[model samples]
Target: MSYTSFREPEASPPPSRPGLLRRLARDRRSMAASVAAVVIVVAAAVVYLADAATKPEVSNAANALVDTPPSAAQAEALGASPSASVSASVTPSAAATASAATAPKIPRTGWVPVDNTAWKAQVSAYNALKVDPVPAGVGNLPEFRADCQYSHSLPDDPIVAPGLPGASHMHSFVGNKAVDANTVAEDLTKFTATSCKPVQDHSAYWVPTLYDNATGKPVETTGFRVYYRSHMSNSTGQMPMPNGLRMITGDAKKKKPTPRGATGQFYCAFYGPGDLDGIARSTNGNWPICGGDATLHFMMQFPDCWDGKHLDSPNHKDHVAYGAGNTCPRSHPVKIPAITFDIRYGAKGTPAGYYLSSDKEGKSASSMHGDAFVMWDVDTMNKRTKNCVLQRRTCDNYGYQK
Candidate 1:
């Protein structure tokens, strides 16, 4: 009777399932948002600390990087992909590190020495081809006497000056030798200028157009550009010039004359290697001529070619001597033909002076001319140059006179 009146208990409503997005959104405040905020703050703090820690380290390490190029370890560390920690570590330093990595470095070539033997050979070859055979071992002559002076009139003057009284100012060194340029410069300071004193320091024997390994004939290097000025006496206090070097006027119209009144007057002197005889000893004294070390005095003057003497002399190789073909005290300015200084070392075509190349054109409108080795600055003839007869000793010194 009771069962008949009993009704089924109402079924519990099926549990409602929450959606994934809804569950995540509902959990965002408790688990995700708060955790994410804390995580962000901690990450920023780590980055700040890392930045602070690495700045001084990077600053100190930057100079070291310059001195010693990056090592494998440093490079690998830089290339590693960034994680949270890595990003914190590298972000502040990335710019500095990139700069350090890419900063310009002195090329290996800068520290390395160049072999000048090729140039030396070129000079020798040129001499061998000349009508007159250049003498052997030309630069081995003994030192000039302390007071010895070169003759300006005669073709050869024994212009040998002694090293300084206490210490030799002139150092006897050759190409790329182990001699301190500064010490040699100091010695040059003690050099007292006489009429015969050369205008250059630290002569390195050379001859133009020499062939390979031939050593055909050596020439006494007459001039060079030194790093410091050794002669304060010669300077007019107007402006400082290269050390142990003198500036002389080459071409007046093309170049300004020497401010200190120096002229293009230069004499030619020849020297040969010394033997056991006293003639060619290392002693500071004049070298005698006629087999006494083969010293000869010559001037840079140009004699008339038709005079039947010194007529065939050429300036360099295959080039007409300076002022050649130009008459003296003549009706008009003499036009001198220009030749290229070097086909291999210089630009194509005949140079500015004389016209004598396949690329030769008419003469330049200006009387002044230049070759690869010599340039005339037409600003004024009064301007001075490092040397009167340029040898183009340095890279900067190359090009027609200027």
Candidate 2:
């Protein structure tokens, strides 16, 4: 009875439980796997951040390549100078490309086709005309005059420093009243206001302003005479000057001493008997002192023959040449009217001397220069060339022979 009581219903053995050591081992393995997964996730995130940081650098390098200037070889292949810097990013429009392709190539020497179609047609018509025989015993001078008065002053030069206002030194302008740095060939025709006689002459003339060294004040011109003449003795076959012709005379960069006998030294001009080389010399020996009723005067002359191709050249002088004896050079076959500027100023010389606006050193007056931008009515130009220049007669402003 005691044994039976002790056995109290043997409960079924508790469901087979996993050993504690085995469970612990399994949990440790799971922990190790989770740790490895976290490490992998961190490594992936770091890689993503590093790759993102490098992408901008790569894009910047690509853009730099696109903006690089053309190489020397590439420029040569494109018919451009190696020194000419060009942007690779700028793509020319189709219309511009076509225009460039059709444009005439500038020649290294000799005549080339005129680039402007309208001008080319005019040239052809003029070349086809029959040249009338020059009258016997005609005077050697074949000239027409355009007497101009000073119009205004500005620090602009359309030929040398176009479109850049105040880039140049102060200049005294005559003839065309609306001339500025932004003026072009068409603008000369459009702005018809002029300070010259025969209002038809809408040309522009400019020279560096003369300044008094002692007062630092500008001495403007009182008389500006622009003469259009033939340089050749035989004026046959001379053509009318082309519209939009530009010319420059005297070297503005010349800084040499202009002593008493200098070739282009400023001189005295008066009606009565007075010394043309000034009454006294300046301290620097470059300026001349005028006597009573005398004034300062300068003369600038331009070439008379053109290349018949370019309206202008890189140097602004390569397109024209002075005739030798009675013949023009082969390269400049087209004879044109020569331009002469007689500029008179009201100031007399002082001991301090005078200086041109182009002269920065105030040492001498050797930097004197002049520029001419010629524009005229086509019919008027033609008539003057035929009646005065071609016929070897001196004509006044009204195109009438004097």
Candidate 3:
């Protein structure tokens, strides 16, 4: 399988690392294009086809996918093998965006709606432990980096709205090409060019594409990177990501900086060191544009603990919970690998900010929502990730035959 290394077509060399202030004011734009997501073993590419504005009614047959979250039985089934699909019975709803008069604090914990409250005490204990992953943006650490550009828009969201069509907000997929609403854990094991490095990790990762509500057009997600090796690298023991492990962080309903979703966050990236400045929002947490050499960046950390019994939760995210002070909660005592996404977009300034697919502002990143639908072959994960992340090796170029 061939993976596409991130580089713009005949693009200028990456600009020299500029000042944080300059980067914040005029962060450079990435060389981007449209694509179509296809599962090709060779480069297993996602062909670019920027259709964020298209909203094609490919089929009017009441899409069983992209329609709603899962039911109790359905969640239980998928926890085993992400092959089940959400029914068209449920509808998606986010709280209305608050007025823009003030920027609210990001909530302490994420806005997790739970069907099983059993983890509450665990969460409290977990929170009480105060063992959080090393704080983000600690650029001083020896960070592992693997950069790859995006292939295209994936209207097929296999994780959130699987097996059915149009049941999910469109996503920008990477790694596996065959992933659609119907993709399963078995499908991920087959060889394919993944967008992630160390190619061996044929795991798929994606987020809702950002859109400019002003123009109703898609914003270039460009290519992003995978960062590993944090300050806690040596202390934490890791395990492979179980198949069908699904999670969602951040609220799509928040248009501004509201603590309603704290575990999920939205902040800015300056080229230099300074406190992350707050951006204006539209009630649903849509950030205003950067005024300096700043760029918009998103960070999402997955739960480090698992219950060892369930793979998914009825609420789609309540099954796995965050570790307390870096240690897995007793309820979720099984310590798996901790995954965090540090995504930076090449954009700057306030006139036209961003929104995501399900944003309340109509196809904007304004009400940015993030979802992670993972499917990895347990065996492949044992080596591709467990060995490297657990052993504290900053590995890249995955899948290259030894």
The numbered model that scores best in TM-score is: 2
- lDDT leader: 2
Best to worst by TM-score, what's the order? 2, 3, 1
RMSDs, each prediction?
Answer: 30.6, 24.1, 22.4
Model 3 C-alpha lDDT versus the unseen true structure:
0.47
Q: TM-score for all predictions? A: 0.16, 0.69, 0.55
Report the lDDT tens digits of candidate 3 across residue range 1-402: 123433434534346745654644343332222211121211111111110111111113222231122234223422322222222332211211111112221111112122233333332333233221333332333233445566567676655555456766767766565566666555676645667665555566777877665676766555566543333434253444555466666565555443313434446677776335344444344454444566767776666655544545545555566655545444454455666677877755344555677653442343555555555433445554443555454444442112
C-alpha local distance difference test of each model: 0.21, 0.71, 0.47
Model 3 misplacement above 4 A? 1-146, 227-237, 253-265, 278-286, 362-367, 375-380, 383-388, 391-402
Question: Whole-model lDDT for model 1 versus the true structure?
Answer: 0.21
> Residue 367 in model 2: shift from native, Å?
1.0
Model 2 weakest 10-residue run by lDDT: 53-62
Error of 3 at 134 (Å): 22
